[model samples]
Target: MKLNQFLRTALVACAAVFTIGVSLSTQAPTVSASSATYKTVATTSIKKAPYHKKSSAGAIYNASHTKKVANLKTYPYTTWYATAKVTLKHGSSKALYYKVKNASGSVSGIVWNKYVTPGKSPFGLKYAKSAVALDVNTNNNVWTKNPNTARPIASLSKLMTLYLVRQKIAQGKGTWSSKVNTSNAGLKRLGKSNVFGGFKFNHNSYTVRQLYLAGLIESSNNAAIALGQWVAGGSTPAYNKKFIGMMNNQASEWHLKHSSFVSASGMEQNSLQPYGYSIGASKNANYVSASDIAQISRHFIVDYNDILTDASVKSMKVDGQTLHNYNNLLPGRKYYQKSLKVDGLKTGYTDPAGYCFVGTGRKSGHDRIVTVVLHDENEFTETRSLMNYVYNQNLA
Candidate 1:
């Protein structure tokens, strides 16, 4: 009986040892995916395929997100089907990544969930160097990309010029009908330069309202300079200095730290030599941050809403010709949208600034959003996308 009991105990021990061996054999090195908790999304359950849309540059990785499989540009406009979403440990936090692939399975990889959106490929400011979108009424920043970096603003400087002139008008120092003589030889010489888009001001003169419209709508450098001269009482060197000081003071009053102006028209310092202004360097031009531009637009629109009367006008008769506005987002313009009520804002361009735009739009006239894009290859389309994103997302 003792022998039989010992044999039974040995058999039991052997069985336990086998179980341990099996468990050891099945053990695996902890993989990235195994360490991460994830959920598998059924292919049929997906209502909309996601498309790659990123605010910044990133890459697609393997399932474990440990290996770089592809760059973002590899699958342009390719709709992705998400197979799984994994929440991976990243430093002290966690991030979600989606396992995705194209319809034909040609493109497959893991991408950050923030870099994609559902539905069709929408226009994005991804290519723009700097951008911002803000809700004017609530002072909510909807979206921003390098907003505080100061860059050449080109014609956007005119907005400040307009603001100062409007201030003078408000202070009872000038009227819209105030006539500004353009008989200065330097002013005439600058006006004749076709590249700057100025009118013939040799022996001619224009009212404050006309010059204002010309500067805002027509982007006339001479008209802006003429107005600046009027404000400073002359186009002499001392007067130009005074006007530039005024521009800087106004910016200070507005609390804009990333803005400086050398010319009222936003021309480079060398370009303003016709006005007795000495050229310093090619980079000596108006510099303003995208954020500051948006703020300036908000202040101008809030205080001088009437400027939109001329700003919204697509074309105005100036210098015996129809001068069309450079802002293509206006109604009936190149990039106009029926859903958005885009009104007066501004557009600017230069070699250093590229193509820049400060656009304001309303969904129902009560909800206004201001969008700015700088150094954009497609300013109008990007602006449209920003406006649409703000309104559609209800970010405002």
Candidate 2:
């Protein structure tokens, strides 16, 4: 009897220990953001929690779970970088929430018990004055800041020009081998200081393919205008208008709401006010939102795989002249991000737009990503940083 009793007690003690261990293993930790613990934890950008708001911020989600704003609760503790502190009226006790001011301006919302993580904003989004980042396959907006605000896009305009030229060629409206005569404007553009990737009027006429490549590779204003004229039936005023109309029509077809095109070369031109906001001056330029530019990049890659495949050409041999590709993000080039599998895309810049880039890259175990940056002096830096954050966060 004594032996049996002892065995029973031993078994009970062992079971108790086992239960305690299991309980410890199952429980998650609670730590503040400022706790030296932040370094140990994997930190990323601000993210919408996987969970949904059971009730809107203003609505009372409280200890008692009542509708009264006073009934809303407040958390006793908060971690650093967890949630932005906007002054919003909350309940007297628990589940307190406040207003959050987004880039658009002041806004009202509830910050629940577990909404935003408190800590340093690791994404460096403050540097992105106007930008959009997304996944190509899902078409999801992974991250954006002032994405709808339109701003001038310099040579990035050439992407559309390239697309149109290819479309015309595909439809039998234009041919690569067809001889396109350089206009007097094209000739006069030579030796002008404003011209980029320009040649010195060496040839009277260039093949359609040569002109198109010149614009794409070298970002030559002269080549782009020449191609535009060719598309417009020889660069006449009426013909140019017809071509410009086509560009607008294409933007519409793509459902681009904020993008407007005035010139094929992405040179500065007057833009219309999509939103009536003025410091008493016009917001005119080749305006396009980061979101619109990102979509364009996604569509360009999906629709024309050849652009990615053929973007490897560093320079195009046009008769005797060599026009170089300006995209430094390409493989084996300077400013290349090894982690970012960037094959092809375009870059842009102007006085108003600063520097812009439409970048595409593939991350491991993920689909392609399209990133657009505007109004940054170092476009390359902004693009690379954003790409790194997106891939690391796995937001898509």
Candidate 3:
């Protein structure tokens, strides 16, 4: 989310990448009793045909005929009021298209036949250059301007740091209450060039809890390195090597084919070479597909919720110096959304990753969605826009 991890005066650290860019429910949310309900009256070339939502549409385009359309996670039978066999822009083969209103009863739009039937949306990390949004529970159900592409994930890699540390705690290897000092190796990372969210590494010692919180909350670079060292067997280079392996192992365990991690904190490996650390041959920052990132967040929802709740801390006293979360959407903050039940996941940024956010929120307490925005110019606003589209459908 920022270069200097130790302190944050504001959440405006990542340079915006905004271009533009969810499933989520089947029933059309009814707003008022007076809203119109049409009893199908077939006439002309029109006929009512019901169709099931495709289990996976890799993406939902706006117009369904060409550009982008908002996608919902809902998969109930949709009543198509009209259908027409037409040629579309995406390909040369002519196919049937439907103008259907989903069960949610929000306004209707054009939908291609394949997405509603036995066929599914196209797949891959296809469109990740501009942005990507995903439904946490569904397979291959996502929206992206560019999927099937590899992109930098910046500080989002800290999610792995969060996961691994919590894994150790769950294993009784360490506890949040454990005490750990800022290793000389960590302190040396304080002024490394190209590192972000910088904070002065003044204190030599802090509770294990403090350093852990700094990595997730403030995205403190040194705090992440310090925690890596601590868990890597008492701040030794050899152990840290093993720790990095653990991170990759976790990714492999998740079957994230397009994802790779060279560091625990998501900083580019070569960028840190001046500080005497090399991340082996790739010399890259962490990389993850938008879909895998969504799944990673879903894993957070299922396994590491304590980290999520702690991450929702808009402000916390870390060693008595308050640090603010970079995710501005957390409730009670100036940028929070009143309509959406906003909590948190994480945020990331770097020159290569552009401005990225792995944002999560829900409404009515259960329909959680994890959205990944990569290479965005306006990470926060664009993320809010995508979340709004999902919630606005009244699917939840």
Candidate 4:
């Protein structure tokens, strides 16, 4: 079958199938978005449908449980998108199929797949699975899956820690030159065999600025604990509690419902090993959505850049061992040399969380864009691909 012809037939077939199940209100779920209307079909049949790629832009889709499923008791009348829109070729056609299963044992809804033509914005393509893209310059938000779904933030939690520290510094309670000692207990807690295994610090003495540099630049866990301890008077737990409170306070102040924090370090409990310690467990760590990340980035870019100054940003060295900034895309060509206005940002990863980044960059005099990728498998490739898509297609 010709691609376009096949797509038309598939769309018609899906529509017919969805129409039959529309009256099965208890079984056939209805999903409504500002941009489109969706009807649910059988959940088991989604994997059987074939999908054709119509564009070079990336796409993602996942069959995970909808966030609504968890809150059905509270929001009984809610709707869910069974199949999200993927980009298509102009004047060409493609179709994908999806099944939407309810919390109960039965199939509740089916998604009649439709394809969207690529937009003018290069970065406007749909990401497969649960993904979202935003252009702060135009207030343009595009998402597949639940864009506002809150998930563990991993090391991205450090941005908030840095923010609070900066706040204290601004209030004259602290300064960049302020020195803080690292305790044996703090070192022991941070010395767990993970990212911090390479650091060989004295564990007895370090300045606030020194620890801050290590925490933000190299993402040293000990540095993070040390800074938190210093802030809360040599108690990591107390400091962590206050730090989380600060995060909640910021969330409330910013009207962010999907933001929460439980630890300064994003560690959580390990499910695989009942006794194993997991760094940034899904249950006990910080959580935030893509939009929340954008909001926080805006605060950093527009409001708090002064705090993360070039001097302080560059001042990250541990015991005279200078740590190279992991933000490889920052204003240098070693990673993506030449004409890239990429500046400082944070990167995070964990087994449960996958790879995540909250990156910011600019193109000449064009609008500054913040690109965030969460729960990505190959974060480096994904980040470069997204950035290339934005620079070549969207921002250019």
Best by lDDT: 1
lDDT of 2 at 26: 18
Instruction: Report the number of the highest-TM-score candidate.
Output: 1
Tens digit per residue, CA lDDT, model 1, 296-371:
8888988998877778888878658566687777888767877788886888876777888888878863478888
- Indicate the worst ten consecutive residues by lDDT in candidate 1: 1-10
Over 339-364, each residue of candidate 3 has an lDDT whose tens digit, in order, gives: 66668878888888877788877655
lDDT, each prediction: 0.70, 0.58, 0.61, 0.50
Residues 212-238 of candidate 4 have per-residue lDDT tens digits of: 767677666656655665665554455
Q: Counting only residues 3 or more apart in sequence or on different chains, how many pairs clash (N, Cα, C under 3 Å) in candidate 2?
A: 16
What's each prediction's TM-score?
Answer: 0.69, 0.64, 0.66, 0.60
Error of 2 at 252 (Å): 1.1
What is the number of residue pairs that collide in model 3? Answer: 44
**Candidate 1: clashing pairs of residues:** none
TM-score of 1: 0.69
Candidate 4 lDDT for residue 12: 12
Q: List the RMSD of every prediction in angstroms.
A: 18.2, 18.1, 12.6, 16.3
